[model samples]
Target chain A: EIADAAEALLGAGGVKVGGALRGRHVLVTSGPTHEPIDPVRYIANRSSGKQGHAIAAAAAAAGARVTLVSGPVNLPDPAGIAVHHVETARDMLAAVEAALPADAAVFAAAVADWRVAAEAGQKLKKDGNALAPLALTENPDILAGIARRAEGRPRLVVGFAAETQNVVAHAQAKLARKGCDWIVANDVSRDGGHQSGIPGGVMGADSNAVHLVSAAGVEHWPTASKAEIAQRLVARIAVALGPQESQS
Target chain B: EIADAAEALLGAGGVKVGGALRGRHVLVTSGPTHEPIDPVRYIANRSSGKQGHAIAAAAAAAGARVTLVSGPVNLPDPAGIAVHHVETARDMLAAVEAALPADAAVFAAAVADWRVAAEAGQKLKKDGNALAPLALTENPDILAGIARRAEGRPRLVVGFAAETQNVVAHAQAKLARKGCDWIVANDVSRDGGHQSGIPGGVMGADSNAVHLVSAAGVEHWPTASKAEIAQRLVARIAVALGPQESQS
Candidate 1:
């Protein structure tokens, strides 16, 4: 890590300086969107936003101009990045679209796939009876929307797959379905693949093990801190973007 | 507050030294219970656990042996208190039941009234279609369950009501229905009635306005910091329980 930092310091001299991603614009999304059921209740995905925030921080450290659209999380905003805090999937999509035309975009948020079709204007009363089943509507597919952009599409679009079973296979399917350039997949089950040995598993754990699935093939990353995984991902992004000539 | 602390210090010389609740056991429940829809998704009430945690801290400061049963919250456990962390309302109820026969019990948790009837073991897939309405079953009413206890009932049982409208009315009804001694009720709406003027309102805010509802009637408390409200509540509890002569 020290060597990489030192090399990045000495390697670039022009408009691009410091890290390989210098002079590039990278957009990232983090945390879990909260879909409100009423004034005091909501539905949400379980996410700490650790990995996504780390990625944004790493990108910023790499000297890239970073725009981070985050959901409600306990984490502080990463330094030197444009951050937009949002609550629901619809709001997140709007924010991401507004910060567009980036070199690369990483969709790391555990956005709800569906939200309450009819959110209550007031708190629903419990009258000693069973509540009617809550109807749900599909939330916009943010990854697919950005990846399938007809105009001003980012050069690289990345998505994340948090699965309990068939991690790689599911990730591959998601990558193809979303039309994203790559998919970062991880097992989030309490047991089985990529176990962090932590009580809550990778969802909120500091460490993670992931598989990078792309058109070329699959690459299994060793268990490491979420920060380390983020740094590695940023480094890979820099490589994929290639030389300064191609960057222009 | 400083004068009160000093008075506590100067008063009492035996087992009741420092504060009125000395040598007493107080049980508190805080935060919002999460009811899982699947391995990854869940429904929850919006709560910061600040008020409940503050009450626990205040009780401990009053020299009480505090047993706090907390749901998922970002706050640290109060010093010199027995804290049991739980996720779902059922687990919270079990933990609370285990730490019973207390002098007082405070149900400050914004427990879910209902939970998904069928919790999926695996992540539910998004198969390019609208998802069916989620069936929900009623969760155990921890406050009512404890308040209605025939044996080992606490001398003082307090419940909290987070309402969007008809704050005092709802609280009064809740006190009678739950059979709890008192109800600390607050308005949690975005606008009007006890508005904290904060972005997220009273749920996660530092300050709050509450009404203490009991069979004795309602006592309106002005908007104050949650800590202040806690201290005031604890003081009332101490007074209600009366001098240590009733200790044995």
Candidate 2:
């Protein structure tokens, strides 16, 4: 059935699939990681988990048993994919570890960089005059953590870079710092309006343009729907994973 | 009021006057360049126009009277900025050239790489089993064109690479091929899923993680809101464009 669908989509130039990632275990992280400021308030991004969810869907469509470690979002679980839901960045990390021993990992989740040093169980009353600064500490970079894991490190690890200016420069830095196989850099600024809403909203926009950077060099993909991008990406991954050789 | 708002946004840290780009005109191309397959079936992306739009906003925020050549996206025009909208890649190139006398240029628009060589006057009939293969040809690389221009070449030209494999290697190649100062690379594969839409379908998501790659080295930014990312990038660009003494 899948082959027939591929044939229909690709026409005469049907996708050549010998053994591309036939039985690969792929792990994906999506949505925004929450860092608790208090029981009620937390620091998080306006990520809707649309991109990550779509990727999970695409991966499953490509025949990979996918483990989706997703953040808090209202998206329905992609059909035929296993999903684990969490809130804070710490919880996400723990979940990734539990689903480890995978062939590859894609860190698409917007993990928070800082967490309140202390979570206040109860809301504190504000003094009338001045407020003291809340202390913050850096969260563990899940991509780096997975990349530097002592055992069972996935063969390929990818990270994301969202910048407004000098996007390439910043993305290069992240590739080195995260030690991941690839980094997706984009600029998200107010003029662009973040977290707008779905279908047309921030989390579920249909189309996207991005820069794909790695040790090899850069390749620019023109604007296309997320689903199309995912299909192309999955095909590329199959090739990179030695799909043809495995099939033969 | 705009100045005050900018000052407040800048807080204590701000771009220094008389920098590398002090007198340079910078033109940035952003958003998704549309290709009219038909009036209704045009090709685009989930680009929210966020990254490119943010780049334009940030450039203006950094004291550049940026002429933001944008594509069709439901975004409010940034204040204190000049904007031009175009539909196709060819139109985009024309706009970029019109915005000439630029000191730098950032080709951030996700221009469609291929377009239907000819557009059908009306929607073609869906005859059973007889599908028309849409003839496609490559669109000119706008970044490469600007970089290789014989006359009035922008001192600094940046191109974006959206690749799925061997990202760094590919970016390096683009840097040389596009003949630009820098190349922003990203992995828009299933693993990275940078093109996801927002929830309830309203706004574009607000966070991203990326790398800044260049000849110097790669710098990584942990996951953060796109707004924060933009601020940091603008700061970097200011430094890059600033006077040698200020950069030091």
Name the top lDDT candidate: 1
- Residue range B1-248, candidate 1, lDDT tens digits: 43354336334431233467887899999999999988789999999999999999988988889999999999999998999999999999999999998999999999999999988888889874328789999999999999999999999999999888898999988998999999999988778444555333798888898998988888887788898788778877877776655556
lDDT tens digits, residue span A1-248, model 2? 33244434433533333235569888989987766544223445546677777777777777788999998776788988889999778899999999998887888887776566776643222223113344566677799999887788998887876554566777888898778888876544333324452112223466666677888877666566666655555555555565433544
For model 2, what is the alpha-carbon lDDT of residue A5? 44
Off by over 4 Å in 2: A1-19, A128-130, A190-204, A244-248, B1-248
Q: What is the C-alpha lDDT of each candidate?
A: 0.86, 0.65
Clashing pairs in 1: none
lDDT of 2: 0.65
Worst 10 residues of 2 chain B by lDDT: B121-130
Candidate 2, residue B211: how far the Cα is off, in Å: 52
TM-score of the A chain in model 1: 0.89
What would the TM-scores of all predictions be?
Answer: 0.91, 0.46
Residue A155 CA displacement from its true place in model 2, Å: 0.4
